[model samples]
Target: MEYFALTNAWLIPLMPAIAFVLIGLFFKRWSALSACIAVFASAVSFILAIFAAIAVIGSGISVDAPFVGHVIWAEAADLHFEMGMLIDPLSVMMLFVVSLVSLLVQIYSIGYMRGDKSFGRFFAYISLFSASMLGLNISANFLQMYIFWELVGLCSYLLIGFYYQRIAAREAAKKAFITTRIGDFGLLIGILLLQTVFGTVDFLELRQLLPSYIASYGTGTLTIIGILLFIGPIGKSGQFPLHVWLPDAMEGPAPVSALIHAATMVVAGVYLVARAYFLFASVPALLEFIAWLGAFTAFFGASIAISQREIKRILAYSTISQLGYMMLALGVGSLTASLFHLFTHAFFKALLFLCAGAVMHAMNDEADIFKMGGLRKKIPIVFITMTIGVLAISGVPPFAGFFSKDEILSAALSVNTPIYIIAVITAFMTAFYMARLLFVVFFGEKTNMRLHHISCFMQIPLVLLAVLSLVSGLGGYIYDFGYWIRFGAPQPEHMDISIAVLSAVLPLLAFILAWNIYVRKKWSADCIAARMGVLYTISFHKYYIDEFYAVLCRFFIDGIGRVMYFIDIYIIGGIINVISGLVLFSSTLLGKIQTGQTQRYAAAFLCGVIILLLCGILYFNKISGITAGGGVL
Candidate 1:
């Protein structure tokens, strides 16, 4: 307890960073030991994270900046970012979730990536990712958070492209990085503007400073900033118009997908919005827009997920859809609900992804659900774990996802009927698609290309996560911070059991519908295509969102890059060449005069001195009127 009292939360993240450096720097030399070190370091950090969370929760909102430590990062504007940690409830929850999932994934990777050539490097990157995410979670100020935000993005890029030998993996990683960077730029500007307006980036300080001006911005400036800040979440959380990178991110290893996409990186956007909920709450219109955006993304992502053939891509789009629910919770001023969903989601989604990894490991990395069938008998542990994950994600009764998803849906209904409708429809689609995936993969005839056995290590984590997915809801954690903590009064009433039952039943209906089409009736692609025509085409193509992005990228980013390349080649290079020619000519002329003779150098020096003296004398005489006037001189 004393150590917890004095220890900086920064130490939790620092340990992983140290591990990353040591493992990565000598990965090739250390090989097997490097991974062990990475895993050990992560395990330690995970333990520290739990201690930090306990300390934070026990102490409960100390505002004295207890662990303040600093170095001069910048001086001109008096910006001094201290290397410290803030241990509020929000930060504590994020620390626990991130550390727990990251530790499990790292351990699971030991089995999944057992014989890979880059195993050491893989663990190193995983450690770096854990450190960055934990740092981002506990950051005391926006600048520090932003730095770690970009660091997590960097780790995501590296991990997503870990199989650099594969072109698809590399391309997917680049797309993920570049797309998210666009939103990050918006986030950076919003943070700078906040600092300009509030004079500080510290969260507690800004929270206190913002209430007075809640009415001053007249909704215009606040809306712009709020929306700009929301852009970061849109990109990071895989919302509409910026969600293209996430599905393709399935090209990475399954373990990477489990940690980054399902449990951590993708959730950063939701965390950002929830973290700055006060700013958004001040701009009602912006919050409303966020609600609509989340609703749209949920419907859009779920619809696309319905048709995905790849097992991981289905989960990837499922993540996008589920993240939309969290965004909806945030947009509707249900920050605690969003965080609650985020917490429960970490367990279930991670369980789903890890189970997927187990299946992939058994099938020699085959991810096509169409090619996989009746795997339950072969991989019973995976089947059971995945069933729990699917049930949880489907919002079945008593499961973790049931409570969180129902809470968000209830909140959305209370906010607006339209959003509730959209959310409910998305839930139905989620169940349908997820069940469709499960039935086809585990309950059908055997169609697998090859099969192998999964290790006990991989199965254990999957089983543990599955249990969490089922029972985390029973912990009775409050989903409304204001109501639970007495920070602010609760607003409107939530929907009752009738609404919850209706919403829950919609998914079962969808499951039956999908079952009729894809399983029981055995509808072929051509038959569905013939029946649905353009509707089928649109769903299959993800409503042409990716194509729209392709056009936009071709006309804007690629076009601008080409223009800049031309300018660099023609105009800038021409000027450089001209300067180079003049320099070369002068060098040629001076080369002849420098014959390695000290006498020649002395003569040139004396000549230059005489010329300077003459010029000085003439200027003094001309300007100072000091021909013979000593007083003026």
Candidate 2:
């Protein structure tokens, strides 16, 4: 039964992979057909994912021993490598989350991208993204995961730069690619170190052997490896310093934003760390780093989010901040809290981005929140759905975000008081900024433009996602998310009463304050901004991070590029030129010596032979005790 189920599960990622090739190559000119193929493929994968989840759950394979589908991939010099599909609770949960969100996004794009020129291409990229993400989720080994990891990054590059004509989109895609690569480099090094120290990269095997290896190698070695491994998640999850690329990623289409933030790309980091919880668990110091980094990032991203006016940019920062919460949960030793938040976040964040897309579609790509007003009546469904999404994200009760986020806060409070404080503050800022977005975009004065009707294609997905946002939290209470993918780690302690109370109160207070400021207009946001002038200025400019990067890029990358260019043009070029000149000179001299006469060639050959014979006689005479002048003188 497990074998049959694993075989079917293999088709989960394969279906979308086939769709990507078929649509991208054959049906590209047939936009409608291409979209149909893509959506059908994704829907099939989603169904298969559902079945896989059921199978994995019913099989009752312990986290220590996942139901792995394996085939020998390589054998070299006494080493064996196998390709594997890991169907444990964690992968199964991620499979459902990814496939569901991917299918809905594909469905939503039908309406959001109707009549676009590169519609076929868009579907192709989207399908490819889904396939890559699914592959990453079920990977049985670190190497396999890394391979799929890069595939998703490639898909992100293609999707983010879907509008190839737009310079901003192209640059954003490039930035996202390059920034993530920094972390990828670290991950690669870590993987190599693991493979060197241990012959296998299998997750299960590694977890079993890691403690022994650490005992043999000392904790310092494990700390180094853990830190290296964490780098990949940091960049992918948009943690702190590497987070700059995420906001710029909004330059892509809004659906892409939903896919990257909600289903696939950014969440990969959190999923990865959770997948390898054993490594961090062994290295206590590294875990503290993860916790502190996550806390700081949560606060950092939320701080920046509050000052942004662009709807997607606000959501982008919000994503970075939320990802921080996930990492913080992991750092606090609660995989359940982290995964729970990841699941709930997927639904609400997707809803939020899709809702934003609907508004952008109506407004002819208008993204500025301050410019939008009185849209509640015009797009009432979006208003309602987006409101729910905002509430969920702000941790309002009964919404998905509240359950997961509260759990994370509780975990933090139990492990580290500082992170707990940071998380609570971030939650406050999250609500304040989200409320600001809602009130400004859906309420207040109306913008001067004819409203576009929400298409059924778009509306269906939003409605579905909103429903999920409201109900997905039930998983935390009912399913014991921590136990589901405990991966040998102990479950987080129950939520602390004080922390839960604070969590309930913070978002509410922030929401009321936002309402008073933005909707009621009783207090000016600008006046408050002026009161907190320096901080506002800094946050508004994203702490000048982009500027700092620009300067570094200009002076450092460009400088190094210039040096390489000079070497290429002068030093290497000069060597090549000298070689060419020597060849040219010799060729010219040989050309002059060439005579189109057999007799001349024969005479030259004879003369050369006579000279050689004369030299030979002189050498013989000298060797026989004869002088060069006359054999003996």
- List the candidates' TM-scores in order: 0.86, 0.94
10 residues in a row with least lDDT, candidate 2: 624-633
Judge candidate 2 at residue 14 and give its lDDT.
90
* lDDT for position 452 in model 1: 78
Q: Candidate 2 local accuracy as lDDT?
A: 0.90
lDDT of candidates 1 onward, in order: 0.81, 0.90
Task: Report the Cα lDDT for residue 72, model 1.
Answer: 48
After TM-score superposition, the amount by which residue 127's alpha carbon in candidate 2 deviates from its true location, in angstroms, is 1.3
lDDT of 1 by residue, 92-125 (tens): 6777788888888887887888888888888888
Clashes per prediction?
0, 3
Could you give candidate 2's per-residue lDDT for residues 492-585 as a string of tens digits?
4366677667778988899889889998989998999999989999999999999999999999999999999999999999999999999999
For model 1, name the residue pairs that clash: none
